[model samples]
Target: MAQSNPRKSGYSFAPSPSSLGAGLSVPVGRRSVLGGAVGLSAMAALTACGGGGGGSDVKEGTGAISFGSNQSDAVPKAAYKKMIDTFKKDSGSKVSINTVDHNTYQEQINSYLQGEPDDVFSWFAGYRMRFFADQGLAGDVSSVWDNIGDDFSEAFKASATATDGKQYFVPVSYYPWAVFYRKSVFADKGYDIPTTLDEYISLSKEMQKDGLTPIGLGDKDGWPAMGTFDILNMRINGYDFHTSLLAGEESWESDEVKDVFDTWAKQMPYHQKGGLGRDWQEMAQGLLQKKTGMAVFGMSISQQFQGAEGGEALEDLDFFKFPKINDEHGTDSIDAPTDGFMMSAKTENGGTAKDLLEFLGSAEAEQINTEADKSIVGPATNVDTSNYTALQKKAVELVGEAKHTAQFLDRDTRPDFASTVMIPSLQAFIKDPKDINNILKDIEAQKKAIFTA
Candidate 1:
């Protein structure tokens, strides 16, 4: 759920609850406590050793550093390589990359960090970054931020900062989650973009009548469905409620949360069948082949069409904000997750690692990245977007116009709960929508245990 870059777009971060829901108090107490707990050791280490190098044992550069990357997909992998190769050429430093499968890397990150992690590794912003940083698994990159901070927006910087007010992650790019379709498909079918929930349902019904699956959904990887849940939750209950629920400050068993599930269940008939057996790439392929009428997906789904052998698959890609469900919320919130890099707490060459981070946070690096992967935009505000594709530009506009932004369900909540509880629980609902009460009860119980522990 995150894409392409916009320079001078005035791209902002999450808005306060006051801005989203009048008179609603956004609770940061729980999130603050979590951040405090996580930043303690990291801050202590930073104080003891001084600056971003982390600790006394952490050494200066040997001109060579290893990197762990989860960008196994060909497009992003090659894109990262182009950026890294340029870094090597520009800085005269040696980078050894240890690439892992994306899902496997995320599943094993805890152990990977506890063991001998690379000097720097690909990571995400928000709760996931703070979670590891709090456990003393990541290096303080504040020093790197000092040099590159001017290149980014305040929101982008906040995304990289833990509750400790210290920087642990360096964001490179982000994209928003929205309903995507092929312009050609809409034109050929004379379909209109839905601006309200009723209109959305009506359009789906029309697609069904035309012998096309109304929605493309694939959850074999378990995380994709969270996007649907996220947009629905925001549209129905508002952004404040969505964030509070993910923070474990709200009961999953509440009627509000149940309403989100109930609504999604009603739309199941419109979604592709057997989603549990399909992956996102397959879903994107179906969209590209025009077998499916529409898909609620992140801009990164463009990668699938970008790889197609021919036709205007990539060129025809377009999206609209998920239609409004509540007049009060009015399509105000979106999931625009930030993806970036973090230095390992145990990096052998702290100096070299920080040096690499400094380069990665530069406008030059972001330019190189966006040039390779049009699906993602750079976080740096100074990035030259002269070459941005039409799709990339619109993505930036969509995110910038939104009143509130979320980091997606998995990134917004505890990693433990997301992977262990929500993933399977959502899959269960997809398999059998009637099991709502049971799913909510199970989620609440697991959330309590996880959050309290």
Candidate 2:
């Protein structure tokens, strides 16, 4: 990590040890948006009962800050575990990590916050964090940022700030969304990364001729499709319209949205079939296995290559920004979601929570995270890139060079609309790309109700 750790943010807490070191997945919906207590309830029970390891020695101000986590997949889980271990060792505070399935956390976040929740929890920036802060659910972290303020860029600081102009989140890491492919696959096929819409389409058709699935698409569990829509909309209509659309300021039934749907519909034939039955993990697997030429996704897809395969296959992984579809946009925008920690408004251990946020914002914590899982780049301005895999280096550059960074679609908009309306709607489009007209109309109707509500 490159970010410099500055002042201590004037928070104090003692350490307590946690037992649940590894993260686990319960597998919620087909595609999940992300956060929660419902998913963590079972895990919490286990943590309370010491099911993950032995027993926890809970303390107050110096006590264990219950950490609500949603890093369900193994790679991030392991990375988080190491990072948490470092925190415990450094701060001498115990963290009882209640790990939950990724999708379940997001689906039940409101209830989780309203219910008794962990003192500190995983969360994203944008409307997601702002919404909770607006509802008085998230604790203010303005003071925490006062000490670590220089560690992050202004853009990241803005993302972590709530609508009320207070910092509610401490960003740690983020990954850019792009067209990921195994370099070996491209090298073997003598394929060059596409730079434009025509080049991309031509490459897809060429891959088909070579008996390779051109694009890997998995809509199961649902939100993976949102990545597709986000990139396409930005590429076609530009970022402002896309962001406005997500905010429900623009009609979903407009020609701009229709054009994105139309483009995706035409490209559907080139996408892997049976998308509704596969998750993003499975789609990443296709790229790893060389069955598919490329997958439009975040670098986190490399999580699938960890453990058994090591970084060799991942070393073969590379990406190109989704090619420019409109000269107006010119690959200027990216859905590079900012992920970080937030404190619950109800946390009785505010001191300990802020202390933990202090450690989390440090370059040391980011170093642990990035080294363990190279898929993510530490957002800390001074992060060390010496140990970075080639892909990580490229990712840092890719994100830094972006003109506009978006918190993925779900994060940028209403959670209800994203999960309830858009998820199903996009899944339907994947099932029948022909009826996009009706699908968008239905979405606009739902958008009206949800945004108004």
Candidate 3:
């Protein structure tokens, strides 16, 4: 999408839900955040798992059901299948999975739900879930929640609850966004962890001098860059301001907001070149290959490390909170987005869908899911943790120690605004850093229109 001048476009603002919540539904705690076992698989030949496979033929009254999944990556894809296979064996039911690319699934969710969506599907928590629930795109899962409520923490439950005080999502796992690096690389280079902005920049320069890309980022999918923006904004402006700004209660043109872009622009020279053309998996490969010093990413990056060429490198993976920029905020916040599943309102069999949703929320299901994906942890409170890897254990500690937690930029705000405005705007900024002034103006104009509408 081209950058549009809202004034010249003369587009009328369409009224939207006025009360998009300002923060997470419930505060995230250490025990409440999740991580799973890190597993490896090659990215090649990993296309849509079940492309062109339709679920329209499944009978509503039969025990068989269809599912739409975005777990197309090798580890998670296999993990989801394991869970479904278990579901089939235990219940004597059939499940047909229609898998799509993760990004495509998210971008086309509106049409998917309105069209021939499967009985249940993968989704996320936060306002993204609420937005769909309010629009009647998601089926109410409060009844499912009632049976499994005791198995989860209040924070996890709240994350799944929509604005109407009803649950529409069943959280499966969560992980924090942080600056990740290979411990071996840092040790070999005699590098120290930087806790302040100046040190962080200086360290990046040293890495560049050492023939390593200081920061490996891939924004081809658009949402990856939002993580960088979210962290920078929270670091420089404080968590409250970041939330307010994204919630549309604050202006995009504010000095605080501009400072974030300015800082990012200064840091962009250290980012991998051609980032706009690369996907996150490639960027993760850079870190595993020792071509990059660090990457600001979620725990899901582990999937890439477990690849055929880099599987053993997963053990050396470690991360630190994004360095503090403003002393007032002092690295007090982090984005720990929760991943989960939701029932489609258009399901042919609500009974089976709800039953599967209940199973998904159970400790037994969480254990199976977390065991398959090495990077995430289950959200269920009673899920076994005796087997958590060191990486997963650290992730829980990192999130627990934070003073504030966000659901990530795309999940924290209006989905329409994120998909339509922020994704393109952030990508535009990445494509051309020199155009900051115009970018801020365009964002402000769009925010006004979208928030009011």
Candidate 4:
């Protein structure tokens, strides 16, 4: 049985593993295999191609443009406010930002989608965007894309583009997710960050033996667990196979995917025993307090901890890329979800919004994001790394050098499939480790139904 939270948490369900059922199985022969340098070069070229416009089209206007975001921190709020101020000054438009509670932001977005649509808003890439785009709530940004050229990273732009090749959103910032642990704890245990599957398990076992929970998991939010599962899946099947599986072209029952879940089941015991019931914030607190040795989470969690407790405790915390699964496929990388901005189809100020989007891609907005601490990996635009901690800089370097970094499963796939198939499948797996095959079978069946329907 899944553990119950004593905290009376509002987010009770085990986070469904995938946000949208975007994962599909593709034939191995059709997968695109671009090296990291090639990928970056392509993105750079894309941006350069789009860089010729000036800011003359935007000036003060009478239109009041409302923006929305789920960012909860003062840092992000202040930085965003500064950007809004700049937008107002340059465009002569009255910009209003509605900051909502992070937990209820999605619901707010859903509600707003039904009522008065704002001019621009923040959204997750992949699955979430698909739902809005498909529903006609999001505007096609192909014109904006041509203007913003190579200013947007190819991967980031691809994230906002649908399979039909139309772009709907513009990315603001993105960061990599990984296992963050205390450097002192590793030193005390004489364990280095693992680079292979065997070493990973062995390290967890040693940590467990020393009376330390190896992972500070909080499935109460479900997303953190989903993040872990995504990383594991990416490593097991490789990015190409994982993408195909999410796109409905492949089966989850494949040996590679099964191995991924089986490996996760083996490590279940190393997680904090009651992790199934804890919220991510609480789990982060536990890790910061040193009650657990590690937490498989996004860089945002690190920023949250540092903000809540000050930087003193965070000095010992460092992160490592998810370990390589096998010697043959040795890319030390993990899921990277890019938070982006999009224009509403209903917005009256399309020109103003377009100007803001281009401004966001500039070095000025990138600096704002860095100083806001909203981005651990910072923006894709060129920025000085001297202000970031060594660990943060290291994460940026790893992502830049990655052979391929996928968006998280929930972010990459479709929402209905994510909520119905992916998340539930993971919950069922947690309920019964021996039921791994059944879980995959169920997911496979769901994928077929959704894609064929």
CA lDDT scores, all candidates in order: 0.78, 0.77, 0.76, 0.67
lDDT of 1 by residue, 1-453 (tens): 122111101122121100111111322232233345665434323323312223314556566899888777666677788878988898788998888866656655654665567899988887778767765668888989989999876666777888678999998888779999999889999999999998999999999999999999988877789899999999999989998899899999999999999999999999999999998888988999899999998887887787475846788999999999999999888888887899987666888898888988888888887887777887777778889988888887787777777888877887667777888999999999999999999999988887875
List model 4 lDDT by residue over 1-453, tens digit each.
010111112334323221223323321221233546685445333323211211122223336778876665565667778977887787677778987755455544543553455677877676567656765667677777787756645656667786557887776666778888888778878888887878888888888888888888777555567787878877777777777788778877888888888899988888877766777778888788777888987776664456544666566778888888755556644677766777676666776677776676666666667665633555464666778777678777767766666777765666577666776677677767788988888888878788775
Model 2, residue 439: distance off in Å is: 1.3
Lowest summed lDDT window (length 10), candidate 4: 1-10
**Which candidate leads in lDDT?**
1
My TM-score estimates for the predictions, one after another, are 0.79, 0.78, 0.73, 0.77
Ranking, TM-score, top scorer first: 1, 2, 4, 3
Residue 375, candidate 4: C-alpha displacement in angstroms: 5.8
How many angstroms is residue 218 displaced in model 1 relative to the true structure, after the best TM-score fit?
2.5
**Tens-digit per-residue lDDT, 334-433, candidate 3:** 8888878888775667778878888888888888877765677777777787788878888877876777778888678876687778888998999899
| Best-to-worst lDDT order | 1, 2, 3, 4
Worst 10 residues of 3 by lDDT: 1-10
Which 10-residue window in model 1 sums to the lowest lDDT?
13-22
Residue runs of model 2 more than 4 Å from their true location after superposition: 1-66, 71-85, 88-108, 307-311, 346-352
| Cα RMSDs, all models | 9.2, 10.2, 12.1, 11.3
Error of 1 at 179 (Å): 0.4
